[model samples]
Target chain A: MIDLSTFLKEMISLPGLSGYESPVREPIARTWQPLVDELSVSKLGSLHGLRRANVKGDHHSVLIATHMDAIGLMVAGLDDGLLRVMSIGGLDLRILVGQMVTVHGKRELPGILQMIPDRLQDKSKAGSPPGITDLFIDTGLPINEVSDLVKLGDLVSFATPPQEMSGGALAGHSLDNRASVAALTLCLEEIRKFNLAWDVWAVATTQEEETLVGARTSAYEIKPDIAVVVDVTFAKGPGVTDYHTFAAGKGPTIGVGSNMHPALGKYFKTLADEMDLPYAMEYMPKSSGTDAMAIQVSEEGIPCAVLGIPLRYMHTPLEMVVLKDIQRTGRLLARFITQLETDTMEKIFGERKA
Target chain B: MKELIQKLCEISGPSGYENNIREAIKKEVTPYADSIEVDPLGNLMVRKGKKTEGGLRILISAHMDEIGVIVTHVEKTGFVRFGNLGAAFPWYLPASRVLFLNGTRGVINSEPREDNTKVSTIDQSYIDVGASSPEDCPVKIGDVGVFERPFMDMGTRVASKAMDNRSSCAVLIETLRQLKKSPHELVFLFSVQEEVGIRGAVTASYAIDPDLGIAVDVTSVGDTPSAKQMEVGLGKGAAIKIRDSGMLCDPRVVRWMRETAEKASIPHQMEILRQGSTDAYVIQTSRSGVPTGAISIPCRYVHSPSEVVDVKDLESSVQLLLKLIGGPVQLK
Candidate 1:
């Protein structure tokens, strides 16, 4: 089996911004190749790995979609020896100052996201945090060399390497979703030991950060009987202990909301309880802000459930997650799939009807 | 039609918690619909006409959700701190009444501030549900509620909370009730969660994959005192939307709606709303892409407790929709 921490570290190291996911897709496909029966890429660039059912006589399938895309910056314009950038996803501008980044130009060059000094900034804006237009990616090259190597529309990703923290936690950029991808990968690996009765599609979706295009198209194509969208949720951390945030290093969260199918959410909660797994019931009263949002409404609508791994400092380069949460999420998914019979739909719908 | 609009407007269905309104709408459309089903996202889809060879699939959508609030925290004193479910403005919340889905009522008020200070944000306000202590509180986290206001009839106009959308729902329902026959297949969709992000229509359109789509909703009017400049106003007939912030109506669909209204001699006006959008925004981009437009009822004070729409506009909207969907919809 592949190591979860190492796989996640490798994923976060790559540059796979929304709509540009080939770099991360390669490693995911390589890892999932030997674990499933078939592997294919959707036209919209989502990685789909199908682990066929061991039981015969036409069974249902479940799509486990985890977005592999990461939030990053793109070169929107070129300044004198510096690059003007625009964010590809939701980024907190306050956290971008002094952050290390890799400018994916003609050659991979290291850069730093730097804000203009207060002395040189507009008088009224001096005390305020700089906006995207006020920031620049400064590579240590001359203007001629910088212009030669970098072009407009080049992608820039966080260069922060994954760091192991106290209590078996890991920190890095793109862990918002890469952690979920590692969990789904762990589920795929663990399910190999079970004689599964339903086909399991482990899909590494793209463009979840910007558009849900990847999950939307993949769900329409796969049309799974049920979809389990695994993604990261906010972990309770410094000054951020709110109702929406869960604790890290505990267990995964089973989402309960409009985006989630109530019966499927209950099934996961029941399974977690039976297995003595610690979990939280996260309430996402509106949109779950996951692939489940799109998948739930795809092509006549598929019953959807969302599993969340709590990570701190979400969408930042130093986002952190406890490794145990990933493992627990993976274990829960494996157990659920292994326990799914051919009549699991009936059981779920029965619960719904009741 | 007025009674149906009043009934729908009074129901307590926020963006995500739309079960009550969905049930209410199902009861209204069941007798007229050939097949009625609710999608996973709580969108009520009713199939009225059958599909024939080469017949166009037309999806007529009216969102059932209204902008409201979700309880995020219950204070120690039993006051509820909440978040906006859609676009619940903090300015509109002060001194307003809210009713939770569980039948708990509360009055929204801001913390005491010196005179001339303003409550410009939601965090500065809380809902007093009359629970003196946390233990006595009836509303908990994740509970949703909408503005509690009675629907009012003002001769040619109606005023109520959720009139922004329930008025449109009434129009769609009336269109379904009065239409005798049509060559094209019609799917009347009462979508959920449109105020949040036009979410319900995205999936419903993909499922229906209609050749043409039209959304009937309320649009802001400029006739209000010092309102934002717009070409739409109450009592001006059905507003054939040309563009909004989210989507520009397809020329073909726009032309079809305008031409149909002209031929039927239905009162109509061209609308160019600079702010806000409708379900047609997402429906136009569903799947391989659908040519979509919106028929907006001119509304005053939208997203407030007292949204007013002229009854003449609602009737005209229903008539226009009937004429558009009444025959074979040829886009060419």
Candidate 2:
């Protein structure tokens, strides 16, 4: 069994921005090595761990893709020792000031992402939100030393430590996806003891934030008959009480939209109901904003579904996810995998006998 | 072509919910395409000339989705808070009449601004569905509504919602109908979720991996009243794109398209769109890479419900595509 709390903190503590995922991929590869039968890396740097089915006859495969990349900043230029930065993903500039970060340069340096004081700017422009050019990372070192230590294009990840909140919620940066990765990890651990009818491919896709490159290529390479993508959705919190956001600590969400296959979605709902697990139905209507977007259209087409973990404060430094939700998502994935039969394709494609 | 444009633009299909528009396009191109498949992402992949062996693969793409609003909250008194499905501005949203997918009507309005310190984002806006209470209203949370605009025939100019790509869609459908026989294999893709990002094109491009990719979409025009300085204009025939915010057209493809338009006696102009991009951006970078260019139909007031495009410009775009893809042409 995996300790969810320790694994989550260790994963988020590493610096793996969208295009740069090695720091986080190394730890995940180590943990998933013993659980999977074969492991390989894609040309785009996505980590794939395949577990062949124990069944004797012809078998298809099901892929469970969880993006391991986290949103962070890249060094754009040097501004008088203060590093100018650009967002690597969808970042709201409003929440970036005064946050703690770890700058990966010559050596790791603890720094604070800061903005010029409000009083220093012109009065008319003061009320307006500061643009990316106005924000810089202050490392508290002298100009010459800062220039020598940090170079251009260095990755800067949020350094907020994981905090255990009341009622078993884990709060930290990168929980938007690392939490989903943890859930997939838990699913892999649970399925190791079972005899599945289909082969299982657990992929940690990369660059899902900037582009769907990793997921698109990996899905094309694997050519799985079915794919279920696990990603994070907005959780209900302060200023986030809308139908678009789900209730945090409730359960995982099953996606419904053009991107999600109806049969695959129905299976997840049916499984959750049979197991008496709490889950919500998220209507994507179009893009699920997950790896399923790419996986669904790989090659000819693949029946794709999405399982989303409700996460609060997505794309921010202090994201939060309920620990119980992660466990429930993992259990749901395991149960769904066990239920797949050789005729599952017929069932999913609506060829089932009446 | 006008009837097809009006038929497509009148349907209500936002970024993620492209079912209505997809069905309409499927019915229009069913007779022309050799085979048609709706990808899992809701992109209608229609192919022609599949019998040609070892032919150069060409992909022509146009997005079917338009910008709209998704219901975020339904208040007890029937006031609904909404969020944008794609790129939307609060300045253009006030007092716009919208219709939901389920046939419910609403009017978007905003709270009175006492000061300008805060940005007037979508959060400050709500949709009034004219119900005494939430129970009396048919709208629910997560329901999407598109601007309810009727297609208009402004003499030579046509105007409607979603003309940004529906205009291009009409061009694609017309091209399919007009092309005689092409030695090169052709794939026409009506991509989805393009309003949110250039999302549907990424997978569609990877699936096809065509030798040449051309996205057909609308481009901003400089002919409008006090419009931002752009070289493109309405009634300028087909706009051969050179640069945009998201992509730089491959020089070889650009040269080929320009030569084809000139030699075919099609009225054409060059486009350097300042801000937005089309599906060609993502398709150009797929796999190793595919030489990509875009044929833009010049339009005014893009992303608004009342976008305008010249009918002659639409016809020219269709003719240009037919000339380029009617036979195999060398990329080198």
The residue-level lDDT of candidate 1 at A241 comes to: 56
lDDT of 2 by residue, A141-214 (tens): 99999989986556789999889899999899999799999999999999999988999999999878866767
TM-score of each: 0.56, 0.56
Which pairs clash in the backbone of model 2? A285-B16, A286-B16
lDDT (Cα, tens digit) per residue for candidate 2, span B1-332: 78888998998889999999999999999999999999889899999985376468899999999999999888877898999989876777878889999999989888878885654668988899998677988898899989987899988899998897899999999999998998888999999999899899889988998878999999988777776646578997899987565655665688799889999999998776657899988886687456689999999888887999999999999999999998668753
Where does candidate 1 stray beyond 4 Å?
A351-354, B1-332
lDDT of 1 at A178: 93
If you superpose only chain B onto the true chain B, what TM-score does each candidate give? 0.97, 0.96
lDDT of 1 by residue, B214-273 (tens): 999998887778665454778989999866656556656877888899989999987766
lDDT string, candidate 1, A1-354, tens digits: 698888989998888987678899999999999999999987557899999999878889999999999999877566788897767778988889999999999999999999788898879998898787778999999999998998655788999998999999999999989999999999989989888899999999977886676788788889899999999999997786578799998899999999999999999999999999999999999999998988998887899999999989988888999999999999999999999998899898885532
